[model samples]
Target: MTALAVTITHEPARTILTLDGELDMVSSARLTDTIDAALYGGRQHLVVDVSNLTFCDSAGIWALLRAERTVSAAGGTLELANVQGILKRVLDLTGAARAFRIITPGQLTSP
Candidate 1:
């Protein structure tokens, strides 16, 4: 398992958290930490960039769901930008595809 790193990039009015590496049992906490920080910051609008994520497990899915709920509870919006690979398929199969505003890298150019 690779160490997951979440890079935070501040957007105009939202915070973009770019998650790279593997989100498995070994490194899921890194994701939780970064996402929790974003939520606590009260940014509300979150864009999770998972394009570079190579792998994910159930823990990763749980992390995403927890963050999604947290954002909604705060009356904020959460979106997923650049999700692909197996992670994308799982989200779709689980009917979570509609829960997030999934965007591609090109679509994020508008900021």
Candidate 2:
């Protein structure tokens, strides 16, 4: 199993959390905690960079949705960047794509 690796980068108006590896049940909590901490730190814009994310299961999707709710409740916004492959398909199929501002790989210079 490839453990999820999260790298955080602070931008002027948004915080970017780049995810690598598998975001499964075993690693979803780390993401939740990171997001909670960022929110607590007064981050109003969050961008999840999933360009290097190799796999994402139901738990991962839940984590993303939960993050959206948390951020929204705090009067913030959440965006998913570098979304492609399975992750994109899953979100589209589940109708969760409409819940987020998705930044496809081709739309950005880098994630």
Candidate 3:
């Protein structure tokens, strides 16, 4: 399994997490930790750019849901950008896509 890489980019009103590689059971915790850190830093608008994400399992989906919940609880928002491939299918099939604000690739700007 390819290791998950999360890159953080901070903007004026949001924090972007660019994910690459595989997001599975092994790496979901790390994703959560990164989200927590961003929230702790007073970032209310969170975007997860999954353009480079190679894989994602249920655990990864759970982590994302948890992040969304946490952000909402803090009166914030969590968005998913550049979603495609198998990851997109999984989210759609599982109906998890309904829980997130999915941004199309063309609308993506800097984090």
Candidate 4:
């Protein structure tokens, strides 16, 4: 199978990591590396734009949780944005929404 693709966009004060394709065990490392780079690279706020995310398994959730911990320990915040569809529902169902900051799609464009 072809490897999944994740696109990252950097903005002032925040970096948007847009996760595309599937986020499974293989792709989890990529997400971790990207989030780490953004968080420690002087970006005070990291936003994960999951608008284009097609699939997310348990590994995906683990990746997010690990990133959340790193960002929290670093005194920074990671905001999850543009999460919809099944992923969004699953997050809410699992109560993971309360673990980290979440921004709706509309809010992402406004600020």
In order of appearance, the predictions have TM-scores of: 0.87, 0.91, 0.93, 0.90
lDDT of 2 by residue, 1-111 (tens): 559889998978788899988898889998999999999999989999999998899999999999999999999999999888999999999999999999866644443
Q: How do the residues 8-102 of candidate 4 rate in per-residue lDDT, one tens digit apiece? A: 77777677778888887888999888877776678768888888888899888989989898988988889999878998898999999888888
lDDT of 4 at 76: 88
Model 4 lDDT, residue 38, Cα = 78
Poorest 10 consecutive residues by lDDT, candidate 3: 102-111
How much is the lDDT of residue 106 in candidate 1?
Answer: 90
Error of 4 at 72 (Å): 1.0
lDDT by residue (21-43, candidate 1, tens digit) is 88777887787777678778777
lDDT of each: 0.82, 0.90, 0.89, 0.83
User: Which has the greatest TM-score?
Assistant: 3
- Candidate 1 vs candidate 4: the lDDT winner is 4
Question: In model 1, which range of ten residues has the least summed lDDT?
Answer: 102-111
Q: Whole-model lDDT for model 4 versus the true structure?
A: 0.83
lDDT per residue as tens, model 3, 1-111: 459989999889788899988888999888889988988989999999999988888888998999999999989999999999898999999999999999987766854
| Candidate 2, superposed: residue stretches over 4 Å from native | 106-111
lDDT, residue 17, candidate 3: 93
